[model samples]
Target: MDYKDYYKVMGVERSATQDEIKRAYRKLARKYHPDVNKEAGSEAKFKELGEAYEVLKDPEKRAAYDQLGSNWRAGQDFQPPPDWGAGFEQRGGMPGNEADFSDFFEALFARSAGGARRAGAGQGGPGAQGMHLRGQDHHAQILIDLEDAYRGATRTLNLRMPEVDAQGHVVTRERTLRVQIPKGVRAGQHIRLAGQGAPGLGEGGAGDLYLEIGFNPHGLYRVEGRDVFIDLPLAPWEAALGAEVNVPTPDGKVALKIPPATGSGRRLRLKGRGIPGATPGDLYVVAQVALPPADTEAARSAYRRLQEDFSSFNPRAALYQGAQS
Candidate 1:
């Protein structure tokens, strides 16, 4: 997807305040509005303007967009960073028609749009007359360690929440919360904390705070759902014969058996050893042969003797046979 520099689209500077952004968007929008211009591509320009304004006008969305950094240029190929929205707390729902927006807008705010629809459907309109209006639900992404998924953990998190100050400038407020992470909570799963969102109006109850789970980059493991994978480095002798090697997992280290003549890229599975769950995922140990260097005279001599012992074995015989065919 191509990156849309919202500031560039609205002809505003990166350091422009909320008021400056509003004025810039208004001027450009008037020039591009289809009803006024009636020129070719005017509608497209107007839609683009709306999309840009949609993000800039809101303190929450603007704060999130700014986190994407300033190195990106307009129209450049773009993909959001893995932890792009992590630690940001924003109220649910987006105003305006979502269909009129570009994929770039949807990519970032689709979750908020969906939350808006769900909230409206379940709780009725917050503006209904004589109704006790519930507060808006909030959403955020929080990162946890892989070990936390194996065993439940408690974490203290600091979240940045954007709001408009009395001067109409966007400002960020820091909020801290102590949260409990349940075992087997996979990435993309949400943990909901009741009464932690925006305050209610009148006699209604406060809305919920939903935290989406994400795993921190693990040093030794990769996770897929509940499954875990780790590279098991084996010496040349261990690969040629069999050996019992210590493998580190989220739970702890365990001795894994290597079969005779194991090759690099072979995967050995340990059942029910991944994230804790009723139907737990398996841990996969991928074999990687670590060859010893022949820098020393003794090592060179050993390699020469081994090469002579395997002189009849042609490892590339299949490649040569394929070429002939």
Candidate 2:
């Protein structure tokens, strides 16, 4: 499929703001309305413009489209990237409106790549007299490990589907299939499994199965884009005396060096060790040095000794700006 330059179609820049894109769309649409222009192909161009704006004016869709990157030139005979839409939120499947676009458009953005195969599906089928309809395509959700997003993995999934019989009675069936979970797939995105949906109507092709992906929340890390954040727990001694602390990451455990006299909330960076493939997103370790709980006599005695050693330290005064307000 030829890549469409949505921005050029709307006369906007790659960084064009939502308002700017919208204004451009409106201006061009008004100028070229076929009802008024009466020019050849004006209607087609106008329809194309509207579709482009519909996707780009909204932040969510625009973001998803942009993440595909500007390396693609409009009108280029292009193939999708090996791992497209990685870290992107996907809109749910909406079947193509045959009345709306060409096959080329359908190929470029087939919201419903797989279709339901139904037997005797029409409102009144000639064979409804004795034929039972095929069941609808089944949808499933798969929650995968975060590492699976960084490095793709395959899973064996068991799917259960319910079908209605001729008399409209519901019966359930289970099917097991092995699915490949592509790396970098984010929440809300789905993988289409061709011919994996329901049985087709009168020998029609089976519908596609869409698999939605979700990341397993890491106990030690929080992910944003490629960057991952972690709260690094530190002993008071480790914070004050400068020590190498063992830190946990999605990849595994590693010794992270902490400079001496580091304060609470201090950030330590581990470059090229975050989510994979994305510049190895940097790991931001926010230090949270902890002291012993003051519930025991031994702990109280230790606190007293530390207070005596640094009695002049006034954390409260510094925190509240000495009651500046």
Candidate 3:
């Protein structure tokens, strides 16, 4: 969707308060209203002003639009991220003349909905008076760790939801809900808690809760797909001659075999040890070779003799062809 700079349209600065926006709109709207001004393109300017005011006047819409930032030029070719504007309801998209806005308004603010015309009925189609369907949709976001996806867990989450009272007033009410954390659920994945949403209108069923997964950064491993990867630091001797090293996993430490001649960045796979699932994922150990400190003359002399003994084994043989005739 194209980004709208309502601030620019209303002729107000980015830092303008709500009162300032209202004042600017009042001044410009009077000059642009076709009925009052009767100038060329007055209608067009009035429509644009109305659109800007419609967005800025509403606190929810204004806050959401402000989060998009001021970097976008007024008319630049724009696109929202895949997840952009997903959670926010497009209030201006309703059907009646109560919101007689254009498609441009709908594109940014709402979605076009059909009235569900069923053929061969006594009535032509379902109208507003027909059957008032659609109980209120419930919205919620739950946070889960990256490891929880691999290993399922149960958690107690504190949920606070804002709801409308019988008189249509906005009120935030709090409640404690214990939710299940299913394995293999990735970040951005939604877990629906059935019938946990707002109560439906009349006799309709309740809405649902959508839980979005999140991960707290792990101390040792970085998760990717079904696999867990960690950098295992090993001594130079362990890398050259192979050794059994203790490595950390989410569960606990385990002895890992480092094969001889294993170079840095060499990966060792522990099959089916990752996040518990019907088909388990593997754990990968990437070798990070560490050298011993050389702070003594004896150590320097021992290294010199070793270098002299195997001096011909220049590892960088492939780098240059002597660069000479």
Choose the strongest candidate by TM-score. 1
Give candidates' CA RMSD values in order.
3.6, 15.1, 9.4
**Which 10 successive residues of model 3 have the least lDDT summed?**
114-123
Please give, for residues 1-325, the per-residue lDDT of candidate 2 as tens digits: 6888788889888866666776898889998898788989999999889778766755434554665788878888866552343333222343347447544345445545243334324224555554444435544555677777767888887654443345433333557789898766655577888766555555445555677665566677777767778998889998988998788877788899899999998988889766666356777899998877999998999999999999998878866985786
* TM-score leaderboard ranking: 1, 3, 2
- Tell me the whole-model lDDT of each prediction, alpha carbons only: 0.86, 0.67, 0.67
Candidate 3 on 103-209: residue-level lDDT in tens? 55676556332221222122224453444333444444455566677668898876655433454333345677788898776655667777665444444555555
Tens-digit lDDT string for candidate 1 (241-317): 99998998888899999998999999999999988888999999999999999899999999999999999999899
How good is model 3 by TM-score?
0.57
The estimated TM-scores of all candidates read 0.84, 0.53, 0.57
Candidate 1's displacement at residue 174, Å, is: 1.3
Error of 3 at 61 (Å): 8.0
Better of 1 and 2 by lDDT: 1
Off by over 4 Å in 1: 33-48, 75-78, 94-107, 110-131, 312-325
Give the candidate number with the greatest lDDT: 1
Q: Which of 1 and 2 is the better model by TM-score?
A: 1
Model 2 clash pairs? 115-207, 118-201, 119-201
